[model samples]
Target chain A: MPVLRGFLWLLGFLLLGETLVTLTGLPVSAGVVGLLLLTTWLRLHGGGLGDIAAAAQPLIAVLALLIMPGVVGAFFILDALEGQWTAILAALIGGTLLSVMTTLALMRRLMGEASAPGEEAPP
Target chain B: MTALLDHLLATPLLAIALTLAAHAAGTRLLKALGAPAWCPPILAAALLLAGVLALLSIDYADYRRGAAWLMLLLGPATVALGLPLHQQMPRIIALWRPLLACLPVAVLLAAAYAVGIAWWLGAPPEILAALAPKSVTAPIALGINAQIGGPVSLMMGGLLITGVATVGFVSLGARLLGIHDERIIGLALGLNGHALGTVRAFEIGPVAGAFASLGMSLTGILSALFLPLAWRLVGA
Candidate 1:
């Protein structure tokens, strides 16, 4: 299928995911669940989604562009966000750093890689 | 002419145009600056857009309406994650155990860290609830927060902060930890970074991007299922 069709195919899965989220009371959003469903579908059928992948690359390349409105919408809650700024920013910082360290440690232990080398990270 | 220009500027399309231009400029600037991983392109672009809108005295709602179509595509863009996940199926299956073992602990620690620190700062329970799923992507985080009885607006703000911080700090962390493997970098970023990290993953390379997508999906699925339940049961 052409890229447009590929887009429609992805859109179709998104709709299905939305429907599932609504009907099944799934905890996650339709989009992520839909991605899971699509992956499962492709894996089951011997896995050929390169067409859609290629089609979506352009859109994904600019994914950040699509996310701005929501960030800007952060304006809506600015008043609520005021007093909590310290806590919120701190939690985010702490959570993020902790997540990286924890994941790295766990993955290192599981993969059993020696963590003793390469202090000089590439720029 | 001024009336026509003013009318055009007021439309949603202008929002889209401004965002695209800012992103392009940000991308170019990053490339010129040797594309340092710490300086997120999206953050730069968002800052630029936010600044311009502030200067122009435009409301976020108007910008959102102008860019409604783009926002709607966030779903499809997320669905597009399947493409990469599908491509990475073999590796995904092979690394299933490591993923399963590592993600739960990692996600739990993140949620705990977020909520714990916030609660210590005397933040309300709803804010704590919103912060629980901060590591997950925005869409899934929204669902997770809703389940946990969090305030939706707070969750959005928290998720954005998590994303920007993830994008900004991953490289620095890698440097300090001496972690150089692309797979590890990508996984760490996507695991914690959410969509912004996925974008960073793609920025570095396709292989990293693929792994980052996997990390992102795993984190989302796991956190969505586990965080709310754990938060309630554990009384954290």
Candidate 2:
């Protein structure tokens, strides 16, 4: 029940977040704004966000299930997709690689000065 | 046979049931195979369900309409990102300087790499828009697509493919850089892959999971704010 209540609060935050996004013309999506708001509230209130995580864990674990319907809808546009497949493949693979590499490199640099250098190999 | 399949798909329950069942089967298969990265259960489930839908002669729209309720979960799931993020606040705050510096550049690199590659390939505007947020989480990517007037289906597709590729790419990057700190690992995963990246990070350990959560949220927020503005600035 407490977990349920926490989820309700989370939903309420999502509603507010969506509303805020619509009104303010923010770049952040409703869901993301909801994330920030809930994080802020949890930070301020001294309550762990664990309950919400626990409540949502099962559904969240299967993250792909929630969006596959929308993704599969792409089948209807295969003709268009075919033309763009090269671009799509390039973008997804290259973009992810660049960002991941940059972030990891930067993180390593930070860890180098803050702690022992060369802390890469961990078991 | 067509009439029978149509009848089965008539109720919203069928969408829910089919999704759950497919995912369950996929999960079981993965478990039996020791959950290899090449065939994540979710991707397998999506493929299986899509194949099944195609076999039944049920179109995408019909399946999505029946799956509308499940779609509603996207919002809550995005909200759930806050939990893991909150837990990682301390480490994030401690490492704020580097993260703050790295985030915008990372977002820009990601957006630029995607748009440039797609544009070079002569992708149309809709595909360009869909691919723009390929590194962002699904709900956020969808939102970006809506704002940019892109194809939502394509956005979802791009997001999924990018996510699935993220686990492998980040690890490969780490190996090349000789950086195996779980923090870097998690950060790379989350920044590039979003939620799926975070999931991969969790497999590594708690520290990796926590940082990956932070990376996912931070990159999302940064890209959401800066990517469009940069998009507008460059007149692309």
Candidate 3:
């Protein structure tokens, strides 16, 4: 029952997200808009909604699994990748490296040195 | 016998069962191997399924018919991120300044670097477009791709590669760069790697996981809203 209620909340948000997009014609993801809305709602509610957690945990656990089928579809279109292989490889390797480094540098600069992992966060 | 086989193949049940079975086997194999970070169970399952389908000559479309049901759950799973985001709100609220300051720059740069690199490599416009949203989660990336006229396959390909590569970069690169703070590491992971990075962040710690989700959700929402508009403005 808790799980069902959780799904209801999720689907309800998702529907609202879709409607929002349709009405506003925003080029955004309905699921993501739903996520933002739910976060706001949860914040406003000011208490843990255990039912959503109950449903959300299991799904979160297997997130990679849920994404696999779509990832695997890339295999079928291997031919489309025939000529662009080197470009794809370079972009992934270089772009990821640059992006990671950029974020790290900016974060370290802006946020300053963070305490080590096990320490309690600073107030 | 032929009719029975045809009927079985025609239904989504077989495909769904195969996906579950393959995922189960992959998880077992991963556990048996001590669960390496570089090789996520989902990658294992994907490879296993790919091998099986190739050997059996089953069409991908047929397989997706059933697997699409599994994909539907992603919408809710993504929304479920709100729970953790809410749980971590206090910390997030505390760090809101750095986070807000960092998000737009990081998000746009992540997209820019990817598209820039691909373009410099002489990738065509469509490939560049596809690469623009690769750092965000797949659904949003795919949605942005659809709007901007990139091939779905290439976008998916870029997304999978970016996800895996970001994990390698973050796990190893953070340590190399002397980053001991899991918050920064987690934020970087989620920012550059999206959901895959978020998963890796969870392995680091709960705090890292929470931050990763925050980064990932914000990145997705930001990229989805802006990238398509940016693509048009760039006129590429």
lDDT of each: 0.78, 0.74, 0.83
Residue B143 alpha-carbon offset, candidate 2, angstroms = 3.3
Better of 1 and 3 by TM-score: 3
**Pairs of colliding residues, candidate 2:** A120-B180
Off by over 4 Å in 3: A46-48, A116-123, B1-5
Ranking by lDDT: 3, 1, 2
Residues B84-168, model 2: lDDT tens digits: 6776677668778887777777767777788888888888776787788888876666556656667776777777678878887
- Residue pairs in steric clash, candidate 3? none
Q: Write the per-residue lDDT of candidate 1 for residues B1-236, one digit (tens) a residue.
A: 55664697676688889888878887787788887777787777777778888887776667777888778889899998787677656655766888778877877787788888898999988788877888788888877777787777778877878887887777887787777766677788888888888988888876568778888888898888888778779774
Better candidate by lDDT, 1 or 3: 3
Work out the TM-score per prediction.
0.90, 0.87, 0.93
Model 2, residue B144: C-alpha shift (Å): 2.7
Q: Order of candidates by DockQ, top first?
A: 3, 2, 1
Q: Candidate 3, residues A1-123: lDDT per residue as tens digits? A: 898888888888888888997899776778888888889999899444887888887878877778878767766777878599888789877899899998988887787765655476532
Selected candidate, larger DockQ, 1 vs 2: 2
| DockQ of candidate 2 relative to the true structure | 0.50
lDDT tens digits, residues B1-236, model 3?
A: 55674687787788878888988999899999999877777778888998888887777887898788888888888888887788778878878899889999999998888888888889999888778888998767777877888777777888888888888888777777788777788899999998888887877777787789988988988998888789879987
Model 1 pairs in collision: B12-B66
Q: Comparing 1 and 3 by DockQ, which wins?
A: 3
